[model samples]
Target chain A: MNTIEVKELRRIYKTNIGVIRRKVKEIVAVDGITFDVNRGELFGLLGPNGAGKTTMIKMLTTLLIPTGGTAKILGYDVVDQANEIRSRIGFIFGGERGLYWRLSGIDNLRYFASLYHVDPEVTMKRIPQLLELVGLSDRGEEKVEGYSRGMKQRLHIARTLLHDPEILFLDEPTMGLDPVGGREIRQVIRDLQSEKKTILLTTHYMFEADALCERVAVIDQGRIVALDTPEALKQVVSDLSVIEIEVFGVPEEILNQIRNLPFVDTVSVEDLDQKQALHVHSAKGSEAIPPLLSALEGVRVGKVTVREPTLEDAYVRLVGGKV
Target chain B: MKPGMMKAYVHVIKLTFIFTLKQSMTDAFILFGIFVQPLLIAIMALFILGDQGDGLVIFIVVGSGLTGLWDSVLFQSGNSITRERWTGTLEALVGMPTPLAVIVFGKNLAFVTQSLSSMIVAYAFASIIFGYPLSIEAPTLFIISVVMTVLSLVCLGLVLATLFVLNPDVQRWQNGLEFPVFILAGFLFPIAILPQWTTPLSYILAPYWAAVALHMSSGGKPDILEISVPWAMMALLGVLYLFLAFWLFRKMLFKARVDATLSGQ
Candidate 1:
C-alpha cells in the first residue's frame, strides 16, 4: 500500500515588489508534481538548488498549503486533514536551526514529546532509548548550543522519533555534515527502515540517494523528470562514457574547443586544489580521448581515465538538460 | 474535549510553561523588564510623589509595579512567537498535532507570571528601603483583582503576539507602544487627567481595568460594589481579547503557511 500519494501538487508564491509602483510577481515554486511512496520504502528526491524539493516536502508536511491539486499521507488529505496527518508523520528539515539551542538535547526531546502528546510514562522510557539510538546518550544533558553540528543533527533525529510516527519526511537530513557525520545519520536511517518506517528523503548528494533510496526521483524546475530505481535511472546515461582529465590550467578557449568537439555530449569543469578536472561525456568512449588531448595540448595535464557512467552522471544528464 | 484529552492538554501547557519560564529566566532583557525597570520607576515615582502621604506611597508602589507587568507583557509575551520564528522553532510548533495557541498560551502564562515579580520588587523597594508602611485596603478584593489582572494580561498577550506576527509593521511600533499604554492605562497616573476623548480608548484596554481594579483595592478605597466595575470590565475584556486572539491565530497560521514566511531567517 502507498503511504504517500501526491497528485499534481502545486505551490505558488505571490509577492509585491517596488516602493511606489508595486508589481506582483508570482513564483511557481512547485508545479503540478505527482509521485507516491509505498509502505516501508525509502524514497529519494534528487534535485539542484531551487528545484522545488524543499517546497514539495513542505507541502506534504503541511508547513505550506498547496495552491492547487492534492496530496494524501496515509490516506488523509494534506489540506483538510492536516491534524490527523501531523499526528501520524514526523519531519526534520536540514541544519541546526530547528532544535532549541538554549535547551539541553534531552530537554528538546522532552519538549517535543510533550508537543506530540506522548504519554508521560512512555516519554520517560523513550527519551533515553532514542538518545542511545542516536549515540548522544551521554551528551544529551548538554545544551544543544554546545553540541557539534553532527551532535545537534543526532539530537534532531532523536527528536523526530520521539513519538515514533509511522511516516518520516527527512528533508536533506545529512546536509552540511562531515563524511563521518553523514554516514552516522545514514546508518540511523537504514536502521529506521528496518523498523518498517516509510521515509521520504530529499538531497542534492547523488550517491547518498543511490546508496539509501529504494527508488529515486530526479526533479528539475518543479517537475519530476525521471522516477525509477537507482539502477534503472543510471540507464539514462548507460550509453554514454565518462572521460575525466586532470589539468593544471585549461583556459576557457580550450574548454570551449572541447565543448565544440563533434562527439562530445557534455563537458563540465570541477575545481580541485591547483587543478581543474574536466568531465567529458561522449558515446565515442575512448575514441574521443586523443582529439580531446590535442585541444588541450598547451595545458599541463595529469591523470586521464575513461569510466562507466554512475548515478551522478545520470543526474547531471537529467538535471543538466543533456538527456 | 474528552477528560483524557483535557489532561493531555494540561500536560502540554504545563511543560510549555516550565520550558518557556526557564528559557526566559536566562534572558537579561526579560530580567530587566521584570525587575530592574520597575524598581527604577518606583524610585523615581517615590521621589516625585513621595511627600504626598502613605496612601500615595502605596499608589506609587502599585503604579510602578504595573509598569513592569506591562513592559513584560508588551515586550516579552509579545515576542513569544516572533522569538520562536527567530530560533526557527515556529515551524516545528506549528506542525505539531498540539494547537499552536495552546503552546503560545503557556508561554504567555509563564511571561505574565514571572513579571508579577515587578510588583513584588516595587513593593519591597517601598516598604523596606523607602521605609513606608504599605498595605492593601481590602486584602481579599486585592487578591481577586491580582488574579483577574494576570488572566486579562495573558489574554491581551495572546492578541498582541498574534497581531505582531500577522503585521510586522505593527511590531515596528512595539517600542512606541510601551509608554502610550502606560499613560492610557493609568499605570502611573489617572486616565481622568487625560482628555475626555481618550477615556473611551482607555476603557477598551485590559490594562486600564487592571490598573483601576488593582489601584482601588490596594489604596483607592473602593467599596465592594464600586470595585466590581473594574473586575467586570476585566472579565469582559478578557473574553473579548481571547476571541479576537482565537481568530487572529488561525489567520496568522494560514498566512504564514501561504506566504511560506515561518522561517524568519
Candidate 2:
C-alpha cells in the first residue's frame, strides 16, 4: 500500500501591506501537484527557494489544509483524519530549529516520548537505544544549547524516531553539515531505509537525491516538473554522449572541415594546449567518434574522455536551468 | 479518542509547565523584590478606605491573585503559541501526530499550573502578611477561583495563539494581556470604584467579575446566595472563552503553512 498519497494539492496565502494595510497580495505557494510515496521507499522533492517544496510537504504532513485536492498517509485523509496521520509519522527538521535549547538532549527526547505515549518501560528501553543510535549516548545528559550544530541535529534524528513512527519526514537533514558529518547522516538514513521505513526527504543536493532517494521529484513553482529515478532523469539527456577531447595545433578551419564530416551534425574547434579540439556533436555520436578521431589523425589526440550525463545536467536542460 | 490522544494532553501540560517555570525563574528574582508591593498595597487600601477595608482587601487579593494568574497564563498559553511560531517548534508540532486540541490543552497546562501557584501566593499573602481584615467563605471562594482560571486561560490561549501564529513578533506584545488586566481587572478595589462610564470595558473581560465574586465570598456584606449571579457570570464567560479559543486555534492550525526552508539537516 502507498504510505503517502498526494493529489492535485494547492495552497494560497493572502497578505496585507502598507500603513493603511490597503495593499493586498495573494501568494500561491503550492500549485496543483500530485504524487505517491510507496511503503519503505525513499522519496525526494528537489527545488529552489520559493518553489513550494515545503508547502507541498506541509500539506502531506497535514500541517496545512490543502486549498484544493486531497491527500492521505497510511490511508488516512490528511484533512479529515489528521490526528490519525500525526500518530503514524515521525518528523525531523534541520539545524537548530527542532530541539529545545534549554532541555537536556535526553530530556527533549523523553518529553516527545511522553507526547507519543510510549509506555514508560518501553521509553526507558528506547531512549538509550536511540541515544546510542544517534551516537549521543554519553552526551545525552547535556543540554542542547551547548551542543554543536551536527550534534544537535543528531539528537533531532533520535527524537524523530523515538515514537517508532512508520514514516519519516526529513527536511534537509544534512543541510549545513561538513562533508564528514553529512556522510554520517547519510549512513544513518541508509540504515533507516534498510529497516523498511518509508522516508520523504527534501533536499537541494543532487547527490543527496541521487544517493538516498529511490525516485526523485523536481518541484518548481509549486508543481512537479519531473519524477523518476536519478538514472532515469539522467537518461532524459543521455541520448547524446558527452565527450571532452583535447588536441594539438588543429586550426579552426580544419575543425570546421571535421564538422562537415557526413556523420557529424555539429562541431567546433578549440585549443587545449597548442592542440585544437574538434568538439563534435552527432546522432550516433559513439559510432561517429572513430571517424572524427581518423579525421583528426594529423592532430595529436592528446586525451579523450566520455561521461554519462548527470542528473544535474538533466536538471539544467529538462527541469529548466532557472529552478 | 485513542489512548494516545489522552496522553498527548499530559505531555503538552508537562512542556507547558516546564517552559513557564523556566520563564518565571528567569524573572522570579526581580519579581521577588516587588512581591512585597502587593502586601503594602493591601495595607494602604485598608488604612485609607477604613469602613470599606474588608471590601478593599478582597479587591486587592482578588485582583492580585487573578492578575498574577493571568500574567503567567496569558504568556504561558499565548507565548507558547508565539514561541513555537518563532522557534519553529510549532512547525515541528504541526508535523507531528498530535492534534491541535492536545497542543492547546497541553500548552495551557503551564498557565493552569502557574495560576495555581500564583493563587496560592496571592491568597497566602492576603491571609497572612497583609492581614487585610477579610473572612472568605471558603467553599464559594474556591469554586469561583477554579472557574475563573480554567475559563480565562483556555480562552486566552485559544484566541491569542492564532495571533502569535499570524504575527511571530506579537510575542513581545503578550504583556498586552497582563498589564491591562492588573490595573483594570478591579482586583484591589470594587469595579464600582470605577466611574459608571468605565464599567463597560471592565466587565467585557470576565476576570473582573471573578474578582468581585471573590470579594463577595470573602469580605463583602452581601449574602452567599447573592454572589451567585457574579460567580455564574464569570463561569459563563470562562466557558464561552474556552469554546472560542478551542475553535480559533483549530482554524489557525488548518490555515498555517509550515514548510521547511532548507534541503538537508
Candidate 3:
C-alpha cells in the first residue's frame, strides 16, 4: 500500500520586494511535482538548494497548503483531513531550533508526548526507552542547550517518535553535522527502516541518498527530473567511469580543457578548502587517465583514481550540472 | 468531543502549564515581570502616598499587583505565539493534532500562575515593611473577586494572543496597553472620578469590575448584596471574552494556514 500519494503538487510564493516602493513577484517553489512512497519504503528527494525540497515536504506535512493539486498521507487528504493526517505522521526539519533549549531532554519529550496525546501510561514507559534509543539516556537530564548537535538531533528523532506515527518526514536530517554526528543519525534512520516505518527524506548529499534511500528522486527547478532506485539511477551514467584527481591550483582553463575531451561526458570540480577534487566522467576510464594527466601537465596533481559510476555522477548527468 | 480526547486535551494543557511555569522561573527577565517589578511598584507607592489612609495603601498595593498581571498578559501571553515562531517551534506546534490555541491557553495559564506572586509580594511588602494594616472586610467575597478577576484577565489575554498570531505588529502596542488599564480600569482609583465619558468604556472592561469588587471587599463597607453587581459583571464579561477568544482563534488558524503565515513562513 502506498503510504503517501502526491499528484501534481504545486506551490507558488507571492513575495513583496523593495522597501519604499513594493512590487509583488510570484516564485514557483514547487511546480507540478508528483510521486508516491509505498508502506515501509525509505524514499529520498534529492536536489540542490532552492529546488523546493523543503517546500514540498512542508506541503506534505500540512505546514504549507499547496497552491494546486492534492496530496494524501495514509489515505487522508492533506488539505481537507490535515488533523487526521497529523496524528498519524511525524516530521522533523533539520535543526536544534525546534526543541525548547531551556528544557531537559526528558522534559521536552514528555511535554511533546502530551501534545501528541500519547497515553500517560505509555509516555512514562516510552520516554526512557526513546532516550535510550537515541543514546541520550545518560544525558536526558541535561538541558538541550547543553547538548551537542548530534545529541540534539537524536532527541529530535525521539520527540517525533513519541506518538508512534506511521509516516515520518525528515528534511535534511544531517544538514550541518560532523561526519560522526551524521553517521549516528543515519544509523538511527536505518534502525527505523528496519522497524518497517515509512520515511520521506530530503537531502542534497548524493552519497547519503544512495546509501539510505530505497528509491531516489532527483529534483531541480521545482520539478522531478528523474526517479528510480539508486542502481537504476546510476545506470544513466553506466557507460562512463568517474576519474577523481586531487590537484592544487588547477586553473579554470585546464578544467575547461578536461570538459572538452572527446571521451569526457561531464567534468565537475569540487573545492576542498585548500585543494580541489576534479571529477571527470569519461567513457574511456583508464585509457582517458593518461590524456587527463598530460592535460594537467603544468599543475600539481596529488592523487588520481578511476571508479565505477556513483549517484553523484548520475545526479550530475541527469540534472545537467553539479548538484 | 469524546471523553478520551477531552482527557488528552486536559493532559496537554496541564503539562504545557507546568513546563511553561518551570521555563519562566529560570528566566531573569520573566522573573522581573512576575516579582521584582511589582515589589518595586509597591515600594514606590508607599513612598509617594505616605500613610494617607489604610484604604489608600491597599488601593496602591492591589493596583501594583494588578499591574504585574497586566504586564504578564501584555508580554508573556501576547508574545507566546511569536516566541514559538522565533524559536522555529511554531510549525511543529501547528502540525500537531491538538489545536494551537489550547497550547497557548496552557502557556498563559502558566504566566497567570506566576503573576499570582505579584499579589503576594505586594501584600507582603505593604504589611511587613510598611506596616500598613492589611485586612479584608469580606474575606470570602475578596477571595471570590480575586478568582473572577484572574479568570477574566486570562480570557482577555487569550483574545490578545490570537490577535498577536495574526498581526505581529500588534505586539508593538504592548507598552501602549499597560497604562490605560492601570488608569481606566480604575486599578489606582475608582472609575467614577474619571471623566464621565469614560464610564461606558470602563463598564465593559472586566478589570474595572474586578477592581470595584476588590476595593469594596477590602473596605468591608458593603454587603454581598451591594457588591454582587461588579462580581456578576466580571463573570458575564469573562464568558463573553472566552467566547470571542475561541471564535477569533478559529478564524486566525484558518487564515494562518491559508496564507502560509504560520511561523511567518
Candidate 4:
C-alpha cells in the first residue's frame, strides 16, 4: 500500500512588481506533479534550487495548501483530514533555524515531544534515547545557540522522531553540512530505512539520493521529469561514458574544442579549488580519450580517468545540463 | 474535545509556556521591556509628578505598571507568531496535530506571567524607594480588577497577533499604537480631563475601563457605581475581543495555508 499519494499537485505564486502601478505576476512553483511512495520506502525527490522540491514537501506535510489536485498521507486527505495526517507524520527542513536557540537541546526535544502528544513516561525514556541516536547525548544539556551546525541538524532529526512518527519528510537534510556530518546523517537515514520507516527525502546531492532512495523522482521546472530507481535512471545514460580530467587552468577554448569533438556528447567543467575537473561524456567511451587529450596539447592535466555514468550524469542528461 | 485530545492540548500548553518563559528570560530585549522599561517609566513619573499628592503617586505607580503590561502585550503577544516565522518554527507549529490557537494561547500566557513582574516592580519602586503611601482600599476588588485588566489586554494582544500574522506590514502599527493607548486609555491621567471628543474613544477601549476599575479600587474614590461600570465593561469587552480574536485567528490560519504564507512571505 502507498503511504503517500499525490495526484496532480500544483502551487502557483503571485508576485507583485512595480512601485506606483503594481502588476501581479503568477509563477508556477509546483505545476501539475504526481507521484507515490510505497509503505516503508525511502523515496527521494531530486531537483535543482527553486525546482519546487520544498513546495511539494510542504504540500505533503500539510503546511501549504495545494493550488490544485489532491494528496493523501497514510490514507488521510491532506486538504480535509490534515489534523489526522499531521498526527501520524513528522518533518524536518534543513538548517538550524527551526529550534529555539535559547533553550537547551534536551529542553527543545522535551517541548516538541509534548507538542507531538507523546506520553510523559514515553518522553522521559525517548528523549535520551533519541539524543543518543543522533549522537548528541553529551551535548544535550547545552543551549542550541552554542551548538555547531551539524549538531543542530542532528538535534532536529531527534526532535522529529520524538513521537515515533511512521512517516518522515526530510528536505535537504544534509544540504550545508561537512562531509563527515553529511555521512553521519546519511547513516541515520539508513538506520531509519532499515526500521521500515517511510521517508520522503528531497535533496540536491545526486550521490546521496542514489545511495539511499529506493525510488527517485527527478523534478524540474515544477514537474516530475523522471521517476525510477537509481540504477534504472542511470540506465538512460548507459551508452555514454564519463571521462574526467583534472587540470590546472584549462582554457575555455580548450573546453569548447573538446565539446566540438564528434564523439563527445557533453563537456562540463567543475571547479576543484586550484584545479578543475573536466567531465567529458562520450558515446565512444575510452576510445574518445586519445583525441580529447591530443586536442588539449598544452593544458596542465593532472588525473585522467573514465567511469560509468552516475546519477548526476543521468540528471544532467534528463534536465539538459542545468544542474 | 475528547479526553485524549484535551490531554494533548494541556501538554502542549504546558510545554509551550515553559519554553516561552525560558526564551523570554534569555532575550535581552524582552527582559528590558518587562523590567527596565517599567522601571524607567515609574522613575520618570515620580520625578515629573512627584509633588502632586499620595493619590497621584499611587496613580502613577499603577499606571506605570499597566504601561509595562501593555508594552509586553504589544511586543510579545503581537509579535509572537512573526517571531516563530523568523525562527522557522511557524511551519512546524502549524503542521502539528494540536491547534495553533493552543500554542499561541500558551505563549501569551507566558507573556502575561512576565507582565505581572512589572506591577511588582512598580509597587516596590513607589512604596519602598519613593516612600509613597500606596494602599488598596478594596483588596478583593483590586485583585479582581488586576486579573480582568491582564485578561482583557491579552485578548487584545491575541487579535493583534492574528492580524499581524495575516498582514505583516501592519506590524509597524504596533509602535504607533503604544502611546495612543497610553493617552487614550488614561493610563497616566483621567480621560475626563482630556476632552469631550476623546471620551467615546476611551469608553470603547478595554484598558481605559481597566484603569477606571483599578483607580476606583485603589481608593481614588468610593463611588461603587463608577467601579462596577468599568469592571462590567471590561469583562464584556474581554469576551467580545476573545470571540473576535478566535474568529480572526482561524481565518488567518486558513489564509496562511492557502497562500503558503505561514512562514511570513
Give candidate 4's chain B TM-score: 0.92
Tens digit per residue, CA lDDT, model 3, B1-265: 6569888889999999999988888988888988998888788888988568887888888888888888898889888888888888889999999988789888988887789789888988899988888877788888888888877878888888888777768777878987888888887767778899988988888878888888788766687788899988988998998899999888887777667776654
Candidate 4 overall lDDT versus native: 0.88
| Candidate 1: stretches off by over 4 Å | A248-253, A321-323, B220-222
Extract clashing residue pairs from model 3: none
Q: Write the per-residue lDDT of candidate 4 for residues A50-158, one digit (tens) a residue.
A: 9999999999998888999989998899988998998799899988788888999999998888888889899999998999999999999999999999999999999
Model 3 chain B weakest lDDT span, ten residues long: B256-265
Q: What TM-score, computed on C-alpha atoms, does each candidate reach? A: 0.96, 0.76, 0.95, 0.95
| Model 4 bad stretches (over 4 Å) | A249-257, A294-300, B220-226
| Interface RMSD measured for model 3 | 1.1
For candidate 2, what is the DockQ-based docking class?
A: acceptable
Candidate 2 per-residue C-alpha lDDT over B10-84 given as tens digits, one digit per residue, 9 for 90 to 100: 656666557545545555532542344444554565456645555555656655566555555566566666666
Consecutive 10-residue window with the lowest summed lDDT within model 3 chain A: A314-323
Which CAPRI tier for candidate 4? high
Worst 10 residues of 1 chain B by lDDT: B1-10
Provide per-model DockQ scores: 0.83, 0.28, 0.76, 0.83
Instruction: Estimate, for each residue in B20-58, the C-alpha lDDT of model 1 and write its tens digit.
Output: 887888999899889999999999999999999999998
Using TM-score, give the best candidate's number. 1
